[model samples]
Target: MDFRAINTIVFAFLITMCSFGQINCNCSIGSYLEKIELLNTRDSLEVFELSAELKKTKLEVCKFKALEIEFNYFITQLNEEKAFAVLNELEDYLGRINCESDLKFNIYINKAKYFKLHNNYEKLSEFAFKALKEAEYLKDSNKEIEAIKQIVYLFTRMDEDDKNWQYIKRAEKLIFKQSNPIRSVKNFRWLAFEYETKYTRTKRKPLLDSLFIFANHSKKGAKKYNIFDELALSYRALEAYSYHKGNAKNALKYIDSAIFYAKKIKGKKNLSGLYISKAWDHLDWGEKELAVKWMDTSFAYDTKDDIAGFMMHHLDATDLYEQAGRLDKALSSYQIHSRIKDSIFNTERTQVINELETKYKTELKDAKIKRLNVLLVITLLIIVSILLAGSVIQLKRTRKKNKILKRAIEEQERLEKELSDVRGEIAQDFHDDLGNKLARISLLSSLISGEVSIKSPNIKSKIKQINEDANGLYKGTRDFIFSLKSNSDYLEEVVTYLSDFGGDIFNKTEIKFTVEKHISTNVKLPYYWSKQIVFIFKEALTNAMKHSNCHTVKLSFGYQGYQLSIRCEDDGIGILESDLQSLNGLSHMKTRGIKIGCELLINSNIGEGTAVILKGNLKEDII
Candidate 1:
């Protein structure tokens, strides 16, 4: 109702809303703490499950940042006694993770602490030096200082007293003049540790006094919960120093203190190495049975495949068994050692030989195939050489025969030319002189027959017979001249003429004749040889048309290289083998083929038609 009352109510509502916001903030904080506890307890799977839930609840950034913080908290919980085991797990975890810069720095520092706690001086120096490099990259002055301190401590543990002092002196030079008292104090503390634990080993009282003074100054800044592991390591260093100084009682006393803090923050994996160290200490005290018992416990906890650790345990077991006169047990342990040594050597030898054996076998097979291929090539070359030699011998004989045949052909050509000239002269004389006289006689006989009438019919018949005989003699002279002219043309012309003549004969016999073009004008043969080949083809076609009673006849002629071939095939009642051997036509064909240096092949059977193939080389005289 009132304006003042409304304003007061608004103010109260604002305060109440602010209060609820604070409560929600506190609840979120509480949940983050619980997740940190889970990580510290090595419950990574549970933390991962919670992270998934957080992502679904719109807290992805919060959950992811929490994971980073939890990783640091887990590192803090890992005690100095279990430092090596924790470092191993941390290394494994780092290998599995893709961590950011801040988280990575924290992991590195924890790793340095673990190596330091185990008194692994070399590894401690290495990791601490690496951590310094990472810190330089990060440009974090605080991490750099921490890394330098760890490195100095590692060198001290390694008995590199001068190097340790050098690093601490450098830190002192850098930080002693700074305005930041806390940083100055921390530097002073490391310098004191370097001089007291490292340099004081040689009984240098002046350096010890300097160490005591600086350590007193460092007390304020050194009060931090995370430094507990470092403190325990410092005590172990003191114990080692006492042991080296020949004060066993004092060394044991410091070792107890070292163990106290080491147990307080022990890690899961590092307990085995710490126990082994403790076993060694007991052995030094002549507590053999207790040392053995601690060693067995250490062995049980050793989950890593650390060769040095296994060897140490093996040697200890062997000594104990041998001293107890258990020869069989000692022998068994020795056999194991021998077996491991042999297996390593054999593995290396096997690896070296494996590649060689593979190459050897491959090359061996290739060589065998190459040998076989060479043998096959030699055999083929021998066969080819024999064939070439036989061909060469036959060709030489053929050349000799061809020379003789060429001489004969030249002589025959001359004789034939002379005979052709004489025949032409004889045909002209018969046509102009004898032919006109016969024609006059025939005209006179006709006139005489007409005048004689019925009284002399016998004389008239005799005169008419004389006129018919004179006409027959003139036709024979004309045919002889044409035959002589036909012999002068090339073989191709002769083939054409014979094919045309054969077609005419087939037409008369009512048999189909198919002529295929065979010889070309380029083919040359002697006049006599050409005449003989044409006559042979003509004769074969005549026999097929007249005697074979063939319905279809195929005539083919072709020239291959120097050889001219003619083939005649007819569908007819074929000749038997007996008849082929005795047939005069076949004998005449063979004789004609021999005279022309041609090969005549006759293929005939009882049902299949006869095929005559004539093949011959063109005479060189014609070309």
Candidate 2:
């Protein structure tokens, strides 16, 4: 076994034990998932480094992610035993976590892929069937269709026409219902590859036509979705079809297009392959010089660090150089290819020998580890029980000691009541004094502006601004009083309070405003909920008057059972699709809704109307 693979598995187990031993980690699972996905996967050392990071997250889900990445790395290196070990670890993790259906389906799919890698058709078919069942149970159409495609690909490889076509039609039925035409791109590519091979062998006209038709279907779907990855592949297939059909111009053109898209995606793997195909097309068209140039370009894209890529590049280079009559270069390429091939074979043999030698020792180690883990869990349970018992004892003792303080508690409650009364009185006095003074300032400014408008035009503008400022100050003073003084904690109070403000404000506007409420009983609400709702309502109403050329606006409040809903709607020239995205106050309203833990949505269409709807659950705390 590779030491890295063994270390990775051991570290993953440590993370599992730590995460389950503690109840919470203060780390967001979603954020950790995003961070894990962004890590470099092209190197084994980076994957090993992820183990230390997983300790920070202390999440079983992170362990699963690490193991999956390690599995893919081993599989890519053709380290079959290590890959199988990782798969077994994954299966164990599934049972340990009592995993979700999606994770279970993922495990089954990985099993199918693993078996396919080993050419175990029987096992592949078994796991594929399991995945299809799991996908159906999960009620995910995309996953179900993917599983069907896997089975279809399996039968395609085995040359089972009946079973292949059976699954294909089933997948197509689901595809039509899904209505995402791009999903068919890979399916069409599979059929095209299958037919193209048969056509190459028999030169049958029907097979040739079917090959081109499926290739074109793939191309159209890929282009429609702007899926550059699949579009590059589809064009490569088209290039092959064109070459076989003896259309030199179209063949070369399609290869160039494939290269263009592969570059767009910065897909080194696909780019290297496409460059090789372009070289072959040129060589077959009797342009040996251009073929040599293209083959050299492919060498630049194929990274030297990738053993498989390096080996394949040299092998192809040998063939191309030999065909171009460059005997010396061809001989050098063949020598390098032979050296790499032998090195890979030797490495595999050595790893296999070491794996067999460690088999018994590994099994013994695993059994001991399992026993240690069981003992650790039992120890943790005992410690937790002890802590909980101590907490209960302390609570009971405190309650007994507090029983003799009843007289003091009663006196404290009396003081609290008096303090609340005094606070109310201070709020009322502050509002009355400042509000009257601001109102007097507004009245004097308005009288002076009326005389100045006829006598001095410039001074009239200044006086009018002073009158508006004074009125604004008065409104601000009243709102500050409301905030400082409100003691109501009921949804009914909020509805009634906002209702009075709406009636007064709309009376001054040409647009009609109406309030409808279905609040039955006084539902308990937190200050934060009521405050944000009031601000959101005011912002929506202001926007409607300024931006929406509306005849009437309606505000509705509703509370029934456990649900609370509010809507601010306007019968105006509704927002255009372009302008709706840039609607001012959208982010502000959304932020407010988020703070109150509510769902907020804006719906509109041209010439119809606009509606801002908010909904949330009334929690059990509302006694």
lDDT string, candidate 2, 1-623, tens digits: 56566456556666777766664422346555544534434356766677557645567766776787778766655567888999998888767655544388878888886876665555667777778777765677877887887677666554456656667667756655665465577667766766765666568778778778888998898777666767888888888888888886788999999888866652124367788888888988999989889988888777564554576688889999999888887899899988976754454554443353245246546756886786686555556655778899989988887875776788888985786677578768977788888888899988887666476878888888988998988876665565555454567777876777777777888999888988887787755687778778877887888788898999999988889999999999888878767766877898899998899998999988889999999877663
Report lDDT per candidate.
0.62, 0.74
What are the TM-scores, per candidate, against the unseen true structure?
0.28, 0.38
- The window of 10 residues in a row where model 2 has the poorest summed lDDT is 352-361
The segments of candidate 2 whose C-alpha lies over 4 angstroms from its true place after superposition are 1-59, 100-102, 172-234, 241-246, 256-276, 283-623
For candidate 1, write residues 1-623 as lDDT tens digits. Answer: 46566456555655765765543221154365444433323344544565556545543334444444444434444445444554455555544433334446666676766654444444555567667766766666667778778866544333456666666776666666566554555466556556655553677657655665665455434334233444455555555455544555665676666567656653443445445545555555666766667666766766534433354455555665455455675577667655544533344544443343345346556766886786575555556555878899989999999999999999999997898787667767766787677677777877777777677779878877876776666544443434456343466666667777777677766788898875555565665675566667777987897788778999998876677888999999998889988999888988989997889999998677999999877655657
Model 1, residue 558: distance off in Å is: 99
- Pairs of residues at least 3 apart in sequence or in different chains that clash in candidate 2: none
